[model samples]
Each structure stands twice: as C-alpha cells, then as structure tokens.
Target: MTQKDAPTGADATIPGKLPATGHQGRQEPAAMTSTPTTTRTSTRAPLAAHGTGRVPPRSGAVLAGLCAAVLALSGCGGQKGGSPAAGSVPDGWGTLATSGVSVSYPKAGSGSGGYTVQTAGERSKYNAAAAERTEHGVTVSLITIQLGFTRADTAEDAAIAAEAGIQLGSTIRSTRKVKLAGTGDARRIDFEFGSTGEDRTPPKGTRIEGVILTGLDSKDRTFAVRVDARKGTLPDADLKRIVDSIEVH
Candidate 1:
C-alpha cells in the first residue's frame, strides 16, 4: 500500500494483514562480542535452538549492559547542559501484557517503545555501541526488542501502543514485506525517526523505521510480538537479518 492509502495523523489505525510475498528468509552470520567483568559469567551467547523453536537468552542482561554503556558514554561526554534529562531508564526486556494480546520482547535490546529518547548526540552515542554495517543502500545498525503478553490477553493493544512515535506515512512507505523461517505469516511496519532533518547527523536517506511481527500460542494467547527500528532505511536483505536475528520460544 502507498503512503496516501494509509489513514492520516500520528494516531491512525494500523492496517491488519500484510502481503505474504514481500519478505524472504535470509541467512547471515551472527557475530557476538563480550567484555569480561569481575565475575566469570560471559555476557553474550548465540541463542540456542530448542526442539525446533528459537529461544533467546533473557533480554535483561543485554539491555542492562547497553543502558549502562550509554549512561557511561553520556557522562564521559559531559554534554548535559542543553540536553534533556535522560528519560526513565527502560524496564528490562521481558513479557509485557496489557489487554488481550501478549508478546515476548526480542533479544538485542530493550522493549521497543520504552527507549530513552536521546538528543541527536545521545542517539549517536547509543548507535555507536553496535557494530556498523550497510544494507539495502540505506545504512543500518542492527537493533532488537522483545514483545510479550500474558495468559488470557490479546496483544492488539500493546501492538497499537508501540506505534506511538512512528510516523504512519513514512512507515508504510519503507516497510519491506517479509516472512520468517517459511512461516506463512508475513510482517511489515514503519520505522520511526527520533529527530527531524537538521537535527539528525546521518544523511537524508536515513529514516528511523520499525519492523513488526505478530503470532498466537496454543492457548490462543497472543505471543511474543516485536517491532524493531534504527536510524535509517535498511536494505530488505539487511532488514531481514535484523528480524530473523530475533529469538522467541
């Protein structure tokens, strides 16, 4: 669907189902690096496959480490004079429930909607923590979040709320239709921009976008839903890598 086809306003209804043919399963190398702490536990590990299902490590450690790194970087820069007070530290990534739908937060980062809105500088500092790579002619840095819902709840409400900062028009335009692991289900959702043109240092091509997915468990409880976004438009190939990288079981 085109941008004009979408409803106007920031609070628009997200379209129901996306076309199934637009996305492809992509295989890419997963590279993990971890720094030693005072303890013996290593922080990073490739999520393991359990009985044909993808189950990632608890998102708590990864998110806490990333937040700590950002706070440290912000302190080092000492640029708080004009910058807004850093917003609430996000909750640890885990299962979140609201109404009927439930979702598991994907690994790689915290919950999608709870990000600390950073100034251009702050956003830049966080982006720098991840290894940089270019895909789809649009520069992209890999990112992830977990989405979850509780028993007896549907994930629809949470999914809608997560679209808050997203610009519906631009989002529809950039979403690449995709399917994961031969599941007949397809996914699509727009990216979100944290700052406008001049405020952003990345070239004009960079548009913050969100990737969304939905599913239901055996009991009919909606399960781990997800939306991922980064600073710019990502090549479909790169976008698939980020989406496929997510693990939930």
Candidate 2:
C-alpha cells in the first residue's frame, strides 16, 4: 500500500524508500519520512472527596438545643424575695379595738367595751405561754389550720403567717402544718395577755378570756382571729357575739 492511502497509527512505509511515479512502477524517496504524533493519559476520581476542615450542618443545631436546655434548668431553681408593708394585710382579716390597744381577727365579728386588739408593741406585747397559767394571769386563744401540698410551699406560707402576726401584736404567736382542711390553707393562732390595774402587772383573780375564730377564703388563705381579755371585764355574751360573727367570703 502507498503512504497516502495508509490509515492513522498503521505501519505503512518501508525504511528509506518511496514509490516511483511510472507506469506500473513506483519510486521510493531518498530519505524516510514520518508523520506528527499525539499521546493521551487519564486519571480516575473517588466518590467522596474531603474539603478544608469545617463543622457539619447538624453541629450548629445541636449546640442551640444544648444552650436552651441550660437556660430552662436555671430558671426552675430561682427563688422569690420581698418584704410586707403595714395595713397591706392579707384578705379576709381585720383588727379589733380594745381600749388603747388592738388585735387581729376575722372581719365577721363585733365586740363591745374594752375587749380590743392592738397591733402595736408595749401596748400589748406577747410573752411565752407555758404548760399552765402563772403570775401573768394570761390565756392563749390558739387555732391551727392544716394544708396539703404536692411540694415545698412551706417557706411561702410561713412568711405570710409571720407577716400577719406582726400586724396583729408584738406578743403574737404562729406556726404551720402541711395538712389542712378542704381549702388546703395551713394556719395557726396565738394570744395576747392583758395587764390589770394601773401597775401594768398581772392582777390577782384577773381571769383571762380567750377565744379563736377561723374561716377559709376563696384564695385558699385561712382566716384565724383570736381575742384574749379579762373574764369579768369582757362580757360572755359580747365575746360570743364576736366569735359567732366571723364570716368567710
């Protein structure tokens, strides 16, 4: 075959020869000739190629979730704090008049004469009440209200009771219980002793008149009002009226 009719990459010419241009004859070139050539190479790639270091998309979402959880936990452990103001007493409670002094009681009752309650100290301060009445000639009107709670509401209830006691008198007494009546408001009551004559000391045969009246309000707050006076000085009928008048709304 001649070189002009040969296919690419196929060995077509003999060394140092060319076909001659003559009838039924060919002449070869003086020097051998060669054609231009090309070469190719290929590289394969992997399915998952890595880039410069970076956080995954889900990492940001996880971090946000963790931050939210920490905030919620901190909020749950917080506490409440404050102080009570005068005359800002809790609802369903009121003060009774007794001469120059006053006492705390339910608003329902009415009393005549000097059988009154005083919230001021020195006017009527509360001293300790022991197993029995002594030279003080005093008696305590005690009342206790029990409540049921699913958790520790004890501190809050105690604070409320203490505030009420302070407003009632300097010699006021108070306590708390976890179990209570249908309303679930726990409570306790104490008394104020009166001094006889001008000496401000316990008087001989000065019997103490004691009574406690209680009722519950819609807000689950218990109302316990107490009255302590001189037996003869405060009429039995009037004292009964005061006790019976306590009405809880």
Candidate 3:
C-alpha cells in the first residue's frame, strides 16, 4: 500500500514530545575573588603537611562542595513572574500546559465544534513548544493557537524572526508592544492572508486573520503565542480572554 500525505492544518497529528532546542538563558559567572596563596616547601616536610598547610581535604568532600557552589551560582538570578495566570479559565474551558507555560481554550461540547487545548510542536516551525490548539479540520471550523519558546534575545528579535513564517500572499496588518506584570516586554502582531489553493482543510482562498503575542517569560525565556482563524471563526472577546490567560514560568 502507498502512504498518504497528511493534510495540513489540524489534520496533522502532533508528535508525542518536543525536544527543547531553543536558546537556553545564559548565566554570567558571578564576580568571584580569591586570595593568592604562597606555599613554602620544606624538602623534609612531615606526611601530615604539604608545602605550607595541612593535607588538602578529601577529594570527595572537595568535589561535593564544588558541585554545591556551581549549582548556587547557576541557580541565582532567576526572574519569576506571570504565574497564577491573569484570569480564570472560561466556564467549561480546558487548559494545556508544558515546557513551563500554560494556556486555556474552550472544551468540546455536545455539538460537533468547539475549541481544544493541545501541546503544539513542529520542529520545522517552532523553537520550543509549550501549549497549542488549532481549532478544527476535516471540513469543520477553523482556528489555531500556539505557545512556543523562541531563541531570540528580545521580544523585538523574536517578532522579526516570526515574519519568516508568513505565507506567500499574507499581509501584515499591525504590530505593537505590550507590557507584562507591569515590568515585562511583549509584542502583539496582527496579519491577514489569502489562502493558496491547497488540497487540505480550510478550503481554498479563505481569508484568515492571525495574531501573535510574544514576550519574555518570568525566567527571561522568550515565548510566542499565536492564533489564526478564518475571519469570523473566533470572536475578539474570546481572543482577548485567551491571551490574558497565558502564564509562563
């Protein structure tokens, strides 16, 4: 039997895990100072003493101390914020969380269509995926949401990096800066696209609206959240709610 190409959009099955390949936050060595040591050696020194001081402590004890020191240095300077998400999950909504981030969405109902929560990762598309949900596929509604940690140093850098993913005919609508917890930096992007004639879902020529909100998480890790939907599939009110619901640890 011949294998079939998976349809694009929500029809694609998500892989079980996303390897975190994004740039990890770097830590500078803490300012350290050491007093110089002057050793005076005696040709016939006693076995209990080295050149000048008592025999060095056991290697195991020294190694344990050094390990603790390294961990202390590497663990400091962690910036924490954006936890306890901005708002409560909407009534009957679901949440997806991973890779230190979380997001909420509408739950499937008795009806055929509703929002979903997922961990979205496409190595070809994202640096580090956390939570994501693309509304529907297979001849149903249309919408997509994604949260990904980026490899950029700043929100501005990540925003520019994101532009590389725009489809051929898409048009950028607007871009703006946002604040997080009153101290963080963020960016919100809006755009539109005319679908290319493709065999997958969403049909051909559908007008799609897109919004991407990106920022540095509490720990200074870069993150990007995206939503794309057929012009009217998702309401603005619900959109704001979702964005407000993000929390990065």
What is the lDDT, from 0 to 100, of the residue 51 in candidate 2? Answer: 6
Q: lDDT: which candidate is best? A: 3
Query: What is the C-alpha lDDT profile of model 2 across 1-249, one tens digit per residue?
Result: 111121111111110000100000011223322111211111111000000011112244544552232110000001122121112223454544222112233332332222122222312112111011112333222111111111123323322322222211122222222111122222222223222222222343333333332224334433333344444544445444333332323
Candidate 2 similarity to native, TM-score: 0.27
Higher TM-score: candidate 2 or 3? 3
Write one digit per residue (lDDT tens) for candidate 3, span 1-249: 000222222122111110111110111234322212212121211111000111122244444543332211111111232232243467767765546455566666613345543322322233233222234343222222223333555555544444333333445554445443222455555565543324333555666565555556655655555555555766666666566665555
TM-score of each: 0.31, 0.27, 0.55
Question: Which stretches of candidate 3 lie above 4 Å from their native place?
Answer: 1-85, 110-113, 118-150, 180-183, 197-199
Q: lDDT per model, in order?
A: 0.26, 0.23, 0.38
The model with the greater lDDT, 2 or 3, is 3
Model 1 spans with C-alpha error above 4 angstroms? 1-142, 147-152, 165-170, 173-187, 191-206, 214-233
lDDT of candidate 1 over 79-189, digit per residue (tens): 112232211112353332223232223233432322222122322221111122223332233232222322222222222222222332333222222223222222233
- How does model 3 score by TM-score? 0.55
Q: What lDDT does model 1 reach?
A: 0.26
Give the Å error, residue 81, model 3: 9.5
Clashes of each: 27, 21, 1
Best by TM-score: 3
